[model samples]
Target chain A: MEFLLQLYADQTRWSTLPPDQAHAEMGAYAAYTQALHDAGVFVAGERLAPPSSAASVRVSADGKASVVDGPYPETKEQLGGYYVIDVADHDAAVSWAARCPGASHGTVEVRPIMAVPTAA
Target chain B: MNSRPAAYAVAERAARESYGKLLAYLAARSGNIDAAQDALADAFTSALERWPLDGVPRTPDAWLLVSARHRLFDRHRRDVRAERLHGALAAAARDAQRDFERAGEIGDERLAFMFACTAAAIAPEMRAPLMLQLVLGLDAARIASAFLIAPAAMSQRLVRAKRKIAAAGTPLPRVSPDDLSARIDAVLAAVYAAFSAGWSDPAGVDPRVSGLAVEALWLGRLVADIVPDDPETLGLLALMLHADARRAARRDSTGAYVPLAEQNTRLWNAAQIDEAESLLRRAARARRPGRFQLEAAIQSAYAEYRFGREPAWNAIVALYDGLLRIAGSPVVALNRAVAVGRLRGAPAGLLALDDVAVRSDLRDYQPYWAARADLLAATGARAEAYRAFERAAGLSVDPAVRGYLLGCARRLGTAQPSAPSSASEGKSPG
Candidate 1:
């Protein structure tokens, strides 16, 4: 099964950390990604730009499209990053997600990737 | 008739012990828990019909497994024929034959099934209901009654929870020990719920609920046996055992509901008490005392009263303080007042009672009124005590408890001797 672990945290938390601490955290994440790669379970993952860089696109009832600055209505924690990992089951995915450095002070919402049926 | 009842007793015992084990074993192997449970239920029904005549199988577990496997094979063949007909018949027959021959290789998988039922990925509220259904083989209605929910709602919740579990995939034997610990709290809560359902008098509506308490105890033992060093597991087992030990003493000779204070101490089950005490000691030695362990320690203090020792009011009050710190339920707070009254007089107990926030929270609560009446009567406030007793009696569901409360109201000014007590929330205290 493949699970998408969407990590979320306060956008300012990383920026407020001391330079050396942020750098150390980056190093830890690099090690974590490397570990996932070593285990051959990592499919794809990436960090996102802060919520300030995010743009929300909405379509009106009449199909008029409008772009808005920042997240849609904002939230306490912004989407920070995500990891897509192929593992045996949900628990394995949860174990892997728990090991992520961001999960120490953030949230990782694990959603199973919907399986698309192949052509017979 | 005698033989029939005896046969039923044997079947009941076997069902209590082997139902989960066999279902878990078959489900683990077959990978279709629903089908496995259906087949196992059919097997039990067949046993009810055939056991008395066949003189009960020498190995009921093996007999049930063999029957369930046949049922599974029949289900598989029916499904296969519905889809592909003769194309799959030969292969399916071979597979079924192989599975039947390999039945002896199946080991107990209930512990793993328990973890799966209480998996952290499942919603917290649904975990206990799921455990009751899948692990203990309780029907949705019985579980609903235990939880005071509509059976349909419980059934829907159970189906959703099962769907979630099935989607998660039962990763048999792959759960790490540390990961198992993370989910232990939910698992323990489920077991405790099972025990409580069994312990409570459900107005004699369902006798089967009573047997489930014993099964819950077995589950606690199984969990404790699996994780012997986990203090909470041991503590939970001790707590259940301690409560169960007083089952005999909970009623008078004429079968009236006797309060712990009024019951003859000699009626309490000594062996169960000893076992609970040892379990409590083990939990204490682990130095990881939690809510259940603290509660067990309080029960242990009450159990001391049976042996001619003064009911350890001081130790019980202290334990209640510790329990309040950890559990902090209003029920525990109310219970603590009884011990406080015993130790520091009725005025102090009433003061302690006042400190409990949200008095309106317990307006409909019978124990609160009962405790209030006890305290008032102790302080020689006959009129107030009588009113409180009337209120408690009005709210009480148990006829015996109602009679006891009413008796207190009738004996207003005479000042009857305050009986020795046990500190519990609703039911007869441990």
Candidate 2:
């Protein structure tokens, strides 16, 4: 099964880190990614820009579109990054989620990807 | 004797013993469970049609394997990809055939198949049904009957489960010991579920249904053999064997329910008791006591009674205490209370029930009410005891048990008004 882990964190906490500490954090993430690759489970992942620079788009039922600035600002937690990994079951996915760096201070939401059956 | 009837008998016996082995072996080798099942079904049909005329082959399993392999080859020949791999497929089939002919066993393929059938990818609720069908070759109707569900619904559930498994692709290689140990509980639960289904009715009117307990025990024994050091597996085998040994005494000559304590110890299967005792000893050697081991130990304590000897109620109480410490379920607590009632005075047992009484799940539980009535009657509280027994009789599904509880209530009512009832005089619940 393929599971998506969405990492969420407080924007201010991430922004306040020292430059060298931020560098070390990135190195840790790289090593983690390498470990997943070695385990042959890595699918795809990416770090997102800050919520301060984010925008939201909504399409009404009538098909009229509206754009908002700053991710609406009321949301305290921001989506920082995500990773997709192939695992055996929910337990395996949860075990991987526990090892996520985000788990220490923030949250990682693990969701199983529903398989859309392909006609054979 | 007609050869046709004798041939059918041999086929029936083969279905009971070798169906799982042949199906599991083919499924593992082919990596296509559905196809393997289809081929094996066809093989069985062919056996029924041809066995009488052919006078039963010396190596029935090998004959069935070869027939199923041919069907597999025919199915593969239709696929373009299989056409390219014909040489490899033929070579593999030959090897499997040779192995089957030389040795009746499938090495560890059945074990591998068991793990695959209960794989985590499949929904937890569906594992046992899938195991019954895929491993034991039980049809959907029988599996549905065992689960008390409509056959159509059971068939649909099976289809969905099988599709999900097939979608996941070929079963993964043998899992690590850590993974095996983690899923051991669920696997054991499935086997026990099958056993309970069989043992639920002591009359054994339907051999297909009643024989499930034997199959489950066989599966448990095979698992214990494969995982020799797993204490819980040994414990599970012991538990099933202990319960199975008392099958004969569970019902009276007239088919009335016989509670464990009132059963004739001579009716118990001596060999099964011996096997269960040995298994319990082996599991105890592991020193990591699990729920099943504790439960088996309790049964072992009861099995020690023989030749008009009193049961070691104190040992049973201690084992129940150990079990309560580990499991802590209301049901186990109720059982422990019965044991305590047998060992200590009725008042002490009544006091112990208070701790478990807080659990809302036991409000209408038959055993709880039955145990409570026994304790109440023991303490000379006839009025409360009568009410509890009435409630227990109302709740009991078994007619014999309901009759017994009603009899207890009537006997208590008719006793002299001033006399305190001897609650501890009757046999404890099984």
Candidate 3:
């Protein structure tokens, strides 16, 4: 089981976390993930670059695959990072999702991974 | 550099091993957010466990969706917050809330998912992968296999797609009666590809593939509702009806095997045949061409002659040519080769199919080899043909196909005596 914690912060709430404090909070997130890893439940995790560095693309009707530069549609909130935690079930995934600093600060989108078709 | 092919394959394998189904029991109660998400999470976890052992169940889409509903109900029982999430889904048969509405995004059901994936904010390369993941519930690794990339690259693409979809906040396209026709095109194309993976499964033993066809049909019906007058929409529905009408007849009563030309036409679906014929005629008269209408026309033509006259290989060939012009793909070319074989002999067809082997997507596809076996035999290369038949038999998930191919191989004097039916078959979408 894997839980994806989608982090976002309202401008006001985000700006209030001073740079130094924000760094400390991120450190806490790292520490929590390390705990998960040491316990052998952590699959993969990463902090995303700010939305400002994002890019987007779409295929037009004429069959053209096009690329553009931007944080895909502009929104006030931005995705900060993600945590993929391996656990027993939804309950376990939820417990792990809550451990992410984003849960306290922004919304976390937790999704379970799909099993693949074994080679015949 | 850190991602080795074997390791990448293993990582991809892990992703596929993890899907499970959740039951949101309280979905009938209220619009509880936590309950809903929890149910979704639970269902996904179940998807992971169930698929490997049981293979994907027939109602996987509904299974996951229902899991969410069940999970929500469980949550409702446990917490006051879930009452609404539980209620909304219960009452949602008619008055469902559109899940996501962003700028420039519209329509209901899976299309919303597709539009989000296709949203301008996401990269062009990200669109198909996103839809493959979210709507079809494929893992990044399986998706990576399709694109022939490392899991990391595929995972990165998905992440990039999600960020754009989230940021775009674009309004979902609201299809008016006027724009409905065009909208249906995009919707059908998306649904067609996904559903095809299900519908084309030779492994009829596994029922899970049924969801793929059912969902595609569901989406096609939705498209029909909006553009009821669109002949192409009608064609798609009619075509499916026509093909499905022969389901029982396609195989013998004992479920052994019966090819289309040998099947009794009296069992042919007259209603579906009628519907497809009408739709095809209408579309042809319109003089405007679309892929669905063309493909449907081809099927209708084939079905029409399947029982009565010699199969109309000429009309079928023409249809494939028209299809190639609209969507020129190697798979399309492979299909067209069959038609050419009918007209010019299997020898000519094999000459054309030589290029099919190198194409990556079709490498694992069993039919490609099966077709090659037939062509080789027809051209008098019986030994080589038996080998081809064996290769196809080795890869096929369908018991019936395996039986049929093995029978062919035996006839050619090359046979394998022991091969167990391992694991299960592909999901046979209805």
TM-score of each: 0.67, 0.65, 0.51
Q: Candidate 2, residues B1-430: lDDT per residue as tens digits?
A: 6967877766655653466777665556555666667767888777767776676777677777778778768867788775444443454456677785577545446666677767778887678788888776778888765654446777898988877766666643477888777677777877776776522321112122245767678778767877888889988898888777877776688765566667788998889889988988988897989888988887777776655666788888888888878777766776777777778878888888876787645643556666788788878899988877765554443444545556677778898323222222112213
Q: Give me the runs in candidate 1 sitting further than 4 Å from their true place.
A: A1-120, B1-7, B28-31, B52-58, B79-105, B121-126, B148-150, B198-211, B413-429
Q: What's the candidate order when arranged by decreasing lDDT?
A: 1, 2, 3
- What DockQ do the predictions score, one after another? 0.01, 0.01, 0.01
Name the better of 2 and 3 by TM-score. 2
Tell me the tens digit of each residue's lDDT in model 3 across A1-120.
Answer: 555556665534555878965654554454455545654777777877766677888999999998887665677667777677677776455545543556555766677788677799
Q: Once model 3 is optimally superposed onto the true structure by TM-score, how far is the C-alpha of residue B171 displaced, in angstroms?
A: 3.8
Largest TM-score belongs to which candidate? 1
Alpha carbon lDDT at B399, candidate 1: 44
TM-score sort, best first: 1, 2, 3
TM-score of candidate 1 to 2 decimals: 0.67
Interface RMSD of 1: 26.6
Which segments of candidate 3 are over 4 A away from where they belong? A1-120, B1-114, B117-165, B175-183, B199-211, B358-361, B414-430
Clashes of each: 0, 1, 68
